[model samples]
Target chain A: MSVLEGINSKALKTGDLPPPSPSPNTFRIYSMRFCPAAQRALIYASVKKIPSEVININLQQKPDWYFTKNYKGQVPTLEHAEGKKLVIESAVIPEYLDDIFPETKILPSDPYEKVQQKLLLERLSDQLTPAFGRVFRAIKNPEELKEKFESILKAFEEAESLLEGAFYSGTSSPGFVDYLIYPSFQRVYWLTFLLEIFPLPSDNFPGPGYPKLSQWFKAITAIPEVAAASQSTENGVGSCKEYMKGLPYFDYGL
Target chain B: MSVLEGINSKALKTGDLPPPSPSPNTFRIYSMRFCPAAQRALIYASVKKIPSEVININLQQKPDWYFTKNYKGQVPTLEHAEGKKLVIESAVIPEYLDDIFPETKILPSDPYEKVQQKLLLERLSDQLTPAFGRVFRAIKNPEELKEKFESILKAFEEAESLLEGAFYSGTSSPGFVDYLIYPSFQRVYWLTFLLEIFPLPSDNFPGPGYPKLSQWFKAITAIPEVAAASQSTENGVGSCKEYMKGLPYFDYGL
Candidate 1:
């Protein structure tokens, strides 16, 4: 992913985030380097080998043009270079990308199986992601943390049952479900290492149960595309610790 | 939409909700008649003219089997009769149905345009829907209510800017964006009539600046499919009043 001109990829501060430029025919992704959601789009692009410009933005102090491009000013906003059409929302952008670039299909070909993958994505979004967020926000009391942990575990168990083959896509290649859940899992792994709050089961530390999900995590992280898009654990932990302190931290600036 | 055999379309109560039946060849939608989210699925089915058995379930007293089907026990769960494959989440099911039955497409043919519609849907989901929910939960203080109302209007204004034609879909017929947003707008209309907490803009009362959105709403509600799927203002208001009072109100049971 090529970094845009005039925007220092390594010096993105709160007020230093550059505005969106007129890209008439170059696909650009407006993102923050460390945001899990942004990483989702990046990982997808990496896996598909779709070359595009990636413009890292500071979420805390967004440029005026950023809000103009997207009312919510959220990251993972895809700018279609040709028409300058912008698509926001983490859930929508990835699917939109897959649809436009049929060369590498992120979604399953079988409609039923695709529906199942979408269902699994929905479960992670609704159940696990929020629990994961609560842990990262570091606002949960002990009892609340316990409840959240239980919910996260339940989500993991459900995911374990959903895995029919080596991958959630039921193929050798990772698809929509894999990309959808991997970012959050990656973040949680970092959180567990840094904070020691809720020890989520992973290949590194396989908890008593959830064998399938643990193995699946190992398989996903081992993918060359995923490995290329991933941030170093030290960098991830540093940024997360800063985030926990309510500091504005962007990995690209680190 | 055919009603399930054992489940009474009327007289559905907490304790009276039936368990999932062994239907091997009939698509089933487990829904609460008055739920806007469920209504979204129903309206999609109506527009597509897909024949499916609609099972009205008492949300407050969901059967144990329902939890087994969907862990969250949320309504608008689509059960594929053949494989017993369950698809939950309001966003996923409608799209799944459209994908399976390609006779009528809810999304646009142009990939970029579909991306735009999805973005609009995301705006509704993130901004307007939550604001509408806050009004219904009826727990916000006066200041918070005012703030939420302002945010809701902001969402409307942004939506107005997004409108390129008579519909958000940029065509004569209502599409994914239309179906996604209309249910929340319909519910807000009812809330305004019943609670009078936040008088949201509609075609009849067009609030000051959102001319496009107001006109779009008028067009959408005028469609035969939407009209058929909608509840009357009297019925909607009555249901809202009952909901506010903690009473069980299902249109099927009424």
Candidate 2:
């Protein structure tokens, strides 16, 4: 197998902090390979081709120092520059990167559009993310499971109406809103492959259920950087199995 | 008693929709005078002196049209010029106003500072809001209530560390961040008045216990517009009594 496929960098656990930022210019992301929120910043960084380095954290067994930087110790934190100024929160991480690197803009310059885009992300965070989570808990109860699926469908139905172009921002490119919400759908689609291991209902799956969302999903997957940044379903299945077994490993069941 | 204190401008309930936008420049806010999230946008707009009219919504009995504007039917939705562009979400409402009315800026101009300000707001939302909510639920349980109070304290301790100047942005003046978080503390402080009515443990009150937070709270309350925009604790007590009875009224014990 190619080394690229074989490369599954182990997550740094307690007492395993990554080396400091290479320089003031290069920012470091405290990320988890399988974490949806962490992948948000990763995809945004990759799409922008920002000078960034990744330090995958063992979210389960976080180092004490991690709390010093972020008391919550959530993944997708950004540390950069001479002061090593930290930016925590998934939404703000890429935002901070976008702020520092204004040349190739992913966020719309028009103020109304930008704030509206943020509103869209807020709606997704409120509705879609929870709807997706309910699916996992409702697996055994077929009716509740189906209801959760439809709820996710309804959120998409609204998105379908609002989606003017290929992406949320406009027709041409995926912007910050796309990246913010991308992880949720990406995780769902990848989880479909783990049906044998986890038994997520195949029939309940709402695939390309909405045309615009279909296009959006396909277009996002085609983005080379986003594709690289996202974990493969194989890796996903393996890590998920490990995560379920009380020991998560980023590598594909190594 | 003064006639001004009697004014609550009754909340528009089911089928009591407000009139159409008077002009392109004029804006409308769907608010609940007692709602903290709604108050966030209200304070921000007032502080910025944005030309806006408020139409308080009886959130418990929301008008159907409100859902058409915002599916979530959350209060503090901003309606503005031309297309009657709707800006939903408390944080986004002020941001939208800030964008449209840039002459009087509440948000920081610096990109890094702006994002950092947002991050601080995110932290408060994560920690303080829920902690306050827990206090309400844990009212009957002393141990749980005390733990919840400490959680609020810890969150404040972190805020104390970050708060150097008068506000989160700097020492000079309160900005968007201050407005964003103002409602939470405001609601908490106002809720204290209702303690006698609700039977919340009087001895457990961590009233301005922290020096920095005390100063920040005092400074936020000093802002003329912010003070004017917020509901009186008397009004809050009345609303809470009404809300507890399953019929909330904006008026102060009318």
Candidate 3:
């Protein structure tokens, strides 16, 4: 189908083919790999087994196109195949993946479960993300780092209390919540291990600690797709420390 | 079917039902009538005739439970239902509304359009929201106010260019994008007129110039339920000017 025909005929899902006249402009994922926001879309694409070319942006020195696409100059600007068909925001992009590849069904099928999944995912995105960002930023200050880690741990405890079982709500299979939590947990591990703020202590949850949550995390990460998406120890050592180095307020005890 | 049976049956669409509990907790919405985020769930519930009780939250001394339910302490929180569910975040709440009232069919029937709707709504939430928020915050600084107003106008121009006619995309009347844009635009009007940003002056999308959008706004406001839910004009005038009264940043050499 022609590109315009695809859009006009409501073939956005079926029209997965790259657009014609696609120069260097085809399917650029404007992203910074270290950014969690960027990682959400990229990692989901990786899991969905879609090949997306990256445009690794120097977020500090944003390009003009980047400004044109997203005035805020946020990463993970997805330029769709058709000219000027841009999808910005990480949480938003995953829905597109879910749309085009309905069979994979990363999201839950039932609507109530869907609500649960969205809420769980958004909680991680909005609440936990900002908190995690703060903790990582304050890693240089032992006291501040300790407080931040405690807050996360407490938040985890609250989450654990709400969980039905190994997974958050329904079953063994990791759905929306798993995707949201996995990336953040990966970052948290790096913070604990490399920064040595709270130490990689016991895997306790739901029994005076979150042992179930620890096990759940282990199970989700063990999935071949999730395992591949995760960072290796060497990669972790480099990237986490590098992010710490670049922040302007690194030494201010944030 | 019984509420418990229906909930257990996993048949409800997201945001379709009043939520299942042995006893239905009466819902009260503490919200500003113009806020789009609040409108998402409100409009849905209103169309469903869900019969929710309302309490206008005085923004200055916001009640305690509002903080407890939402740490960010933003509004349109629906309390007293389904075991005290504190649904935070605009995107999540809208999905919840859809779950409860699938019959309203505010979302597009096609899966692709649904996903497109999700992405479009999210972009509107993220991009437009902050731009609107920034304008509201910079109301005190007339110079900064003008710059931010220009930014808002730029966003509106982009919206105008993208939209074909009647609505954003699809032939369906007032689907996702319509619900998403309506409440936010209501807010833009409140900020622009009462705060004196006057988008009518813009060379590009002079508010009056976009007849379709202007008419659409009028139609949406004309909805009796929407009009009833809206805030008092005098309150808007008092608060907006009071918020801007002391700050020189808005005195942008006009």
Candidate 4:
């Protein structure tokens, strides 16, 4: 299935009020182009074929009115029911979307099987996301970078053990577990590029350490929606570098 | 519906395996008698009428093989599919149970409504649970206790604002949000008794501050499953004080 690029993918920022929200019925995803968390929702929406608008808000220069709608100011916030209600968090939005649009049925229909996927997703979130956070935080403090990188590698190994198939869904195709954690994997893969911007150590991505996860990452990235939702490694690094510098850097994709 | 009490509610210590998992089809919950997180799962199971065995393992002295099943060693680890699969996490277990057993559906089935309940539950976990943790940690440090108490009250206020009805499910009865968070609220409510043991200052559970939550707590506590699942205030305080002393204190329910 071809991934549906949303109604608007423009990098909307500061003054932007979200492209009229597409329609009264249509939901707008508050997003930033380079945000990995928001990208998870974007990819999930694409997979489910949710007809929505993407308002790429500026992280550094967030608009005044955006906070009125989502006070926490987190992305992947779903404004639905004509703004009477909102749903935030990457995992909750997709589960809600899966319910509204059941045709593709990436989430298993059977009671037991669906939960295995949720469990796998939870395990992945626990094992990988925290390690990724540590790596990002350790970038400026080069002393902690190596230890944090090792933790991420160990996390990758944990991820690899959870997979007996091409994906954590225990099937050939990508599922909830795959879509949600792909953003983290892509970031880690792109972090190999970090040597270019900030450097004090050797890039030791040991081939023997994460053979399964490396293979899985290569496989899932080729899928249509993943391609659509993912920003280039170049864009990721450029925006991320500026973001680390505390500068407004939204146009990294170009 | 009356809550179905589990087969064995005994405080089984280190060397104890679960009693026969009720039958082959039945699941077992790894729980600590005094744990609030485990109580969330236990109440959920009871509400869903899941006839399972509860193995209340000593949290301080977890058995050797327990880690083999759940290396994280967190309470509320569910062993199911004949022990071939395990589901951990308080929220995920209930979600899985809700899927398998469709009766007495505390979780909303509507895609949108279910998602709202999930969001409310998530928000409650965010606002209240952490404050409860802070209070627990502040027990030894008398200086931090007042600040932590105020934070918990603020969290309680945040919880009050989320309710427009007697419950978060927008209905007359308790739902997902109510049950998941009740464990934390009960803990905080019981924390008011900390002045007796911890040498804390005045117990200021102001009447007007959390009028809605205070009322809601009273109403929800009357529900059968909540009653079946909760420990008494004296027991809770006894267990918690011993627990704070950091000795092996599992039998405080007596």
**Compared with the true structure, what per-residue lDDT tens digits does model 4 show for residues B1-254?**
43434423566657776455335686788887778898898889877777766777777777777776677787888787677767788888898888777776778888878887887788788888888888788888878887787777777678888889888778887889888888887787677676654322223332456677767877777778677777777888788788777766677754
Residue pairs in steric clash, candidate 1?
Answer: none
Better of 2 and 4 by TM-score: 4
* Tens digit per residue, CA lDDT, model 1, B208-250: 5667777777777877777666677777788777776778776
DockQ-based CAPRI category assigned to the predicted complex of candidate 2: medium
Off by over 4 Å in 2: A1-8, A137-150, A153-161, A196-208, B1-7, B138-158, B196-208
Could you give candidate 3's per-residue lDDT for residues A1-254 as a string of tens digits? 11111111211111233224334434556666456677677667666776666555556555555566665688777766554566677777776668667887687766656766777776655556776778877877887787777667766766666566778646767666777567776666656557643645533321336766678767776776665544464566566676667742211211
lDDT of residue B157 for candidate 2:
72
Give the CA lDDT, 0 to 100, for residue B17 in model 4: 65
Return whichever of 2 and 3 wins on lDDT. 2
Clash statistics: count for each candidate: 0, 0, 30, 0
Candidate 4 docking class: medium
Give the alpha carbon lDDT tens digit for every residue of B1-254 in model 2. Answer: 11122125677778886566647776667787788998887777677766667777777788888787777888877777743688888767776776667888777767777777777787777788887788766766766776777766676677778788878877487877787898787666655676544322222332445667777887787777887778766777677667656565664454
Error of 1 at A147 (Å): 7.4
In terms of DockQ, the best-performing candidate is 4
Calculate candidate 3's fnat: 0.35
Tens digits of per-residue lDDT for model 3, B1-254 = 11111111211122333333324655555454435576666665665566665444434445555566566667666554554565656666666666666776677665556766776666566667788888888776788888887777766766666566667655535656776666677667666456545665322223566767665666666666555544444544444564566532111111
Q: Which lDDT values do the candidates have, in the order given? A: 0.71, 0.71, 0.59, 0.74
> What is the Å distance of residue A245 in model 2 from its true position?
3.6
- Which 10-residue window in model 4 chain B sums to the lowest lDDT? B197-206
